[model samples]
Target chain A: MKRRTFLITTTAALAAASIPVARYYSNGKKNYPPLIMPEELGNFCEEKVIREIGDQYRKQVPQESEKAKLQQILLTDDAGKLTAVSDNAAIAALLDKKIQDDFNSSRILVLSGWVISVTEARQCALFSLT
Target chain B: MHIDARQLDNQSVIEGDICIIGAGAAGISMALDLENSAHKVILLEGGGMEYDDRVQELYNGKLTGHPYYPMKASRLHYFGGSTGHWGGMCSTFDEIDFEKRDWVENSGWPITLKDISPFYPKAHEILDLGAFEWGAEYWVKQNNALKLLPLDDNIIWSKMWHFSPPTRFGTKYKDAVVNAKNIHLYTYANVVDIVATDNVASIKQVTIKNYAGKEHTVKAKKFVLACCSIQTSRLLLASNKQAPHGLGNDNDLVGRYFMEHAELKTGEMWLNHTEPLSFYLMGDKTKVRAELAISPQKQKELGILNATVSLMPLAMSKNTIPSIKIWSQDDPRKALDTFHKYSNLDKRNYIQKLFSKGFYQSYGLYTRSEQLPNPDSRVVLSEEKDELGVPRANLHWALSPIDKKTVYTINKVLGQQIGAARLGRVKLYDFLLNDDPQLPDYTSGGWHHMGTTRMHEDPKKGVVDANCRIHGIDNLYVAGSSCYTTGGAVNPTLTLVAISLRLSDHLKKTM
Candidate 1:
């Protein structure tokens, strides 16, 4: 279905389901907009999830220097910093830790609320920074 | 005397000074208050003292919005009504729930918080709860270790809630109602129709039927519909023999304005310091649990709805990433089982690998927010009929944009509040923060059905007036959450019981 038809169908479904579709359909006339947009908000959520994953990964690795090195590499030029187009493979190549080989660029990920390819996540640092 | 309507003659006529339909929390509470009074009371319970599959089929209906619990499994049809399976989390509605807030559509009640404040203490007794205290100071004083998160009180504060021993009215007050000299308790009395006068201004009698081949007519000086929200509206809408539009439905408002306590897991909170947060935890001996609550002033300032958040440790929270998919299962119980199994496996793995590293326990922020009352969200009669021939209640449980906005704003506000306090960070769930927001699979309700027969002074705006009397009707009243004009973000039992007691007082004066 087209985007407009999709919204109309979804709104009709919501009306039937007892959800408040009017809030969105009203186009901010009565409903207030959030202080932050979806992607911005999702970035924070993604960062949190990735940080937790990193923390768990750190526990298994048992190397404090490796953890610090990985964090530092994510911010440096070698890690494809500020590149408009970057992928997981490019960033992983710069990591000093041998576990860098574990990087899987083609993997699909659901970060925060955004569904994206692993390569797309490299652009946002798993929603930490863009 | 306890009489079985099924044992009565086919056309038996029963008379009383006051007749209360549905012996649930509200009906039983009202009857208990009127015991040994000058006037005689008749209490009608559709089912027997226990659950009956045949009677429960009356609640079977279709769901049209977010997936809800099966209608049949959602509420019990026996004598105690829903209190039979209630979790007994009790708290009073905030003062704001009664006020006509500019932000909330169709908000405000004809009565103020103070109007029902006097009866809350009595209701506490009826519900077998602790004191009437819902303040932070009262609970904090009881347990010194209970320190609220050091957040700005003006923005957010601790809202205390007391748990009930979960008094099942069927088991708790059955004997008292059964033996009351002036109170007549009738079982198996399914009211098929409410017979109103030609003017449709007063209910002359109610006709009830039973599978035992007995039919009866109950007449009273006054009548109260204390059935649960959906059933109350169903009876009013189905009783169209006298009024073409059904009794108390001249405004087409009887079944409108349905509301629920929209419970959602909004985000995760990671405390930087391990304070144990013992006060917020459900203790074996403690009577209350505190949730981070947005103050009414903040709500008005921000144009948000009343909402509260409880913290659940990640180990126990059912919303973990690996298991949240289980919630999509059609059967809520099966979904819960799948979640538990997946969560348990995840928990065991994390404990094995991360326990040695002192991994900080993360907590999930469970949000229970108020739904802005919407006329479009309502209860309507379905084409399906039950064994007793009553049309099943087809529920259109819609959420308003304001309702979704409430969740998003509160989570966002909480994130900001936590960051500002330097306490910890809050990461809102992805779905809530997404542009095309979809309700997460885990979203459900507190099973608090309300606002079907909203109380208002104007007949056009409500099904019942300030006195709980159906507008333009001389003696018909509603005595449950169905009479609520606006539902706050708390369980409805305490406030609803208080409302029922207030109605009892009104009847005592008028009868």
Candidate 2:
């Protein structure tokens, strides 16, 4: 087979493996490059201890404006089908929801408003002026 | 002179007690080991000092790999070698890394971690770290500012990375090494070939050349190839006068098993949850190391053989780009320089805020997976030779499917756990995500390379033996990651240093 054709087929197979059954081939719209490449992520996540969520995007900010930006990083959701986060309110609310969810998950926490993470002791924290 | 000296026209006339080739990490380390030993040592480095302008001319706008000016010392020449510009983050190999795994094909080391424990302390000393310690205890005394992840069940954990104080080997150890009585480090000296007397059984003498087109040779009782992985293997493959192929390419394993950490472009990761921020285990956390941890047992359960994931802060919560923040925030290139200018508390406070304000500079966990030995990833002899006329090595590397899978699993687990624990939101990132394993991710090729010319109980599987001696060859040994059979979840430098120190002990014992 031609290299290009082979690549196209393999790419399709990979895309299928990554996205959940709920996701589908778009009507030829722009696709976000899958951020996570194929290197083994880590086997630890497979432990029954932590549950897996099919829908990667979970929004806590019931707000509309920030939800678009949250989806921008969290999911590609049918591309043009979903409204993009175009407003500052959406970005702020979306950031807040994401932070709150991680915080609830214990991925984020506060002490004197100074954030702390459980991943690596010395590193891994987002800095912001609230 | 400690420098290997002999007429190029008559290699048979060369003489020295010890002849070392490929003056990179391993070579230099061993050279440092033998500095004042009883024997006279001759060192032949393949590359010249201070970045050969002539060789730089050859790179001549041919920017092909990783987009880094392409004209870099993927192997450096000269006195101090590649350590000339290294971001020194050091860690030792875990004991589990030495065990043979039924899961990973050809995954096991001839030597166990215990065998090298004695040398770990010394290796740390050479790298100038505080001591042989890791995990939580190290953090407690420092300050419990950072939140620690629980990765190990029994042992407490703390992770500390050291900056080299801009450790340039030339400036750091130049006077001592060059002026030492027993050590002679030659500049502009390059090893072009390694030939044997009869049956590729022994390397009789090595041919050397300088940029001036002057060729020379050196002979010794024992020869240790210390150059980095590519050059060491390249020299071996290029020397095939008596052998059908080359010196140690008998099993066609001279340049096989090429491995490097494949860095992925993690696209925008959104956290439906807020990412945790920590400052407890900042600089002085060496007291209580257990507070910090990585999920290892979780890794074993997941069928992920060799990989790791660290939470890297994106430019901002909204902008998920990993590296851009360094640039977007007040010009990162000048940030370090700026940090040096001000020693005041205000400057310190400003730097801290800068560090906190929307960008974090760090590495994800090393996918310390083994580079499955593949003949395809082999480094070949390039037509463009170094200044020494020795054939330059053209590396042809392509990540196989297995490589992609290994990367995918590592990120999934780490991202999920970090996200599950609410550490931060991780955007999925596989090494092949961008379809460019060789893309300009700041973390690829991780100068932490290992595996080529690996060690094995059998000669067929490896170029060197347990003691790093090349099997069948009476007095040949290698020092560096090239001798590593199974590289574990730690820096190869510390482990390779451990192995070299063992080589150093063996050399002293035998001598």
Deviation of model 2 at B175, angstroms:
1.8
Reported per model, the fraction of native interface contacts reproduced equals 0.03, 0.00
Give the poorly placed runs of model 2, Cα more than 4 Å off.
Answer: A1-130, B1-14, B47-49, B55-72, B150-160, B265-296, B316-371, B383-387, B419-443
**Tens-digit lDDT track for model 1 on B1-511?**
8998888878999999999999999999999999979989999999998877777777778878755666776778889998876767788888888999998888889999999999999999998887777887887887788887777788788888888877888999999999999989999999989999998889999999888978899999999999889999999999999899889999999889988877877777655544457677653355788888888888998898899988755433432332223234434345335434433222333332332221233566778898888898899998888888888888888777677778877766666566445455566666785665445545687788999999998988998999899999999999989999988988899999999999999999987
lDDT of each: 0.72, 0.51
Distance from true location, Cα of A9 in model 1, Å: 40
Among all candidates shown, the one with the greatest lDDT: 1
Clashes in model 1: which pairs?
Answer: A17-B64, A17-B65, A18-B397, A18-B398, A18-B399, A19-B398, A19-B399, A20-B399
Lowest summed lDDT window (length 10), candidate 1 chain A: A30-39
RMSD, candidate 1, Å: 13.0
- In the order shown, the candidates' DockQ scores are 0.04, 0.03
